[model samples]
Target: MDFYDKERLTALQAKEEAQWITFAPFVFQATRVLRNSGILTTVEAHRQGITLQELTEKIDLPAYGVRVLVEAGLGIGLLVLSEGKYKITKTTYFILHDELTKVNMDFTHDVCYNGMYFLEESIKNQKPEGLKVFGQWPTIYEALSTNLPDKAKKSWFAFDHFYSDYAYPEVLPHVYAFKPKRMLEIGGNTGKWSMASFAFDPDVNITIMDLPGYVEGAKGKLEELGYGHRISFHPGNVLDETQKFPQGFDAVWMSQFLDCFSDDEIVSILTRAKQALNPDGHIFILETFWDRQRFEASAFSLQQTSLYFTVMANGNSQMYDSKVFLECVKRAGLDVVEDKDYIGVSHTLLVCKPVK
Candidate 1:
């Protein structure tokens, strides 16, 4: 975080960064086309690099189309020209091959691109103005089940799953460490975590609490998988505040769930988690706090993602700073017993109990 505190770049260098913002939309689309049109992949395959005419012949586009994109790619730092040939740069290779980069790009392109135009209005209005691009919904969460475009939905799930898929393997051990026989999973979207739970522990019973839209679908598939006896459903909106968490769970788990609501809502949710918990039960909050990240780039990515929350998500929530998030924990009258950082890709798990 300190790396961002001082003015690290010279006036000239700072101006370049500012210019990148000015042309960001064009750069984003151009780089995306280069990746999607297979221009980078083709250049990558040649190894010795390929000439402008060779790249034109290899790709399906017309000569002028290829020429324009290739030219843009060179300026965008996605390509380097040397000896009359263009080669994919390290940045381009990541854009082409890295799973994280691919997911982020797709999520941005399919879900966030058009909606981002409403950011200034969203911030001023204190609402998700961009979500109107999708449908009439207060937030994108509700729209996820019913209204999102097909490609947007696919990219959204892929983006969501990519992070959790990596985190699950590392997170499961900690959840099962207590040998909890019953667990409550809040915001159990699509039963991805439920499925993971079933595989991780054959004996533990899980009660999934979520919006009505997500819970029913998860219930049916889980039941069809013959997990009928192990998984139960509780569909209710947590923001209603009138409805409380179901009681008597040995461990209450929330994974990538809390960041969906405002800080006040988090305190409300965690307070309910405390009330629902058995005397010795611990609440496990799995979240990505930008400051907790091991690398500055990872931190930067999460920080940028907070804007999506502002303009597209609930408009009230965001990727939290650890200090701000922890203050919410204290406000809920919960004490963090174990603060574990760097869990899997970019998560920090806070183990909390009712304040003593």
Candidate 2:
């Protein structure tokens, strides 16, 4: 309508766009800090003393370029410069450089770095224009595991680091709602969710299923939290464990776990879970689903969700609305009595009951 109204709308839009530009550095800075720190904390660094000259020789970069890189790193507090020598920061030691640490600096550098570059494209396209945008790989995980550079793999280990942030707190209320007796956590890396539940609700017994390697680190996490008694580590493929799963469990939870597969694979998984559940057992699905109708859907929360789908799940990650999810559940012979949005920056929660 009026010029004044149009002017106000344009200003609001401009403000919103500027916020993301301002916030982009925080995202990039974290990745840069983590990546540089990982190198400094490496065992090789300790043995040979990874100075700018050594780093240049090792990586085959120019000496002048290495100096600039190291300087920027030092400026960001990721690298300590003292007595004409370089060292890693404390933040990098535990999270990035400690032996077999959860956070992977290389993965962030490769996967997340590219994802951020396309933020504006994603916002404009209303869908991720990542590698898969041009029909590249089916999923980013597959591409990375097979074709990604070694440096990128170093950062991808950070995938496990994100588990705690994505699943807990948001899913806690739902877990409590079901009041589960024998809880089975599929792909429960580090057992953080299980440990948190076991502490809050002492009556529950939590079974965490993950690959054997991830389970190795989870032991310390469980032991550190004094949850060794209540939590059990079962390492195996989740699809293969359906027959052995204890029947009649009050709840079966898959958190941010399903997007790892295609539609056919998801149906297969859900079908198996349906068979594993008792007549009245419940299943919880939590993930990001894009609402094509809402412009506000392109906000920061949505952007992050799309980026993960590109970098991790490839484009196969569906922002399924309740209707789409319900169809899948019903296809698996489950009935959805309640589906509600969880408390988070973005996404929805579906609570399903097995169909008799």
Q: Best by lDDT, which number?
A: 1
User: Could you tell me every candidate's TM-score relative to the true structure?
Assistant: 0.98, 0.56
- Cα error, residue 219 of model 2, in Å, equals 3.0
Candidate 2 local lDDT, 141-227, one digit each (tens): 444435555555545545544544655676676668777787767667556677768767879887776666667667778888787
Q: How accurate is candidate 1 locally (lDDT)?
A: 0.90
Question: Which lDDT values do the candidates have, in the order given?
Answer: 0.90, 0.60
Give me the candidate number with maximum TM-score.
Answer: 1
Residue 25 of model 1 has an lDDT of 94
Ten-residue segment with the worst summed lDDT in candidate 1? 1-10
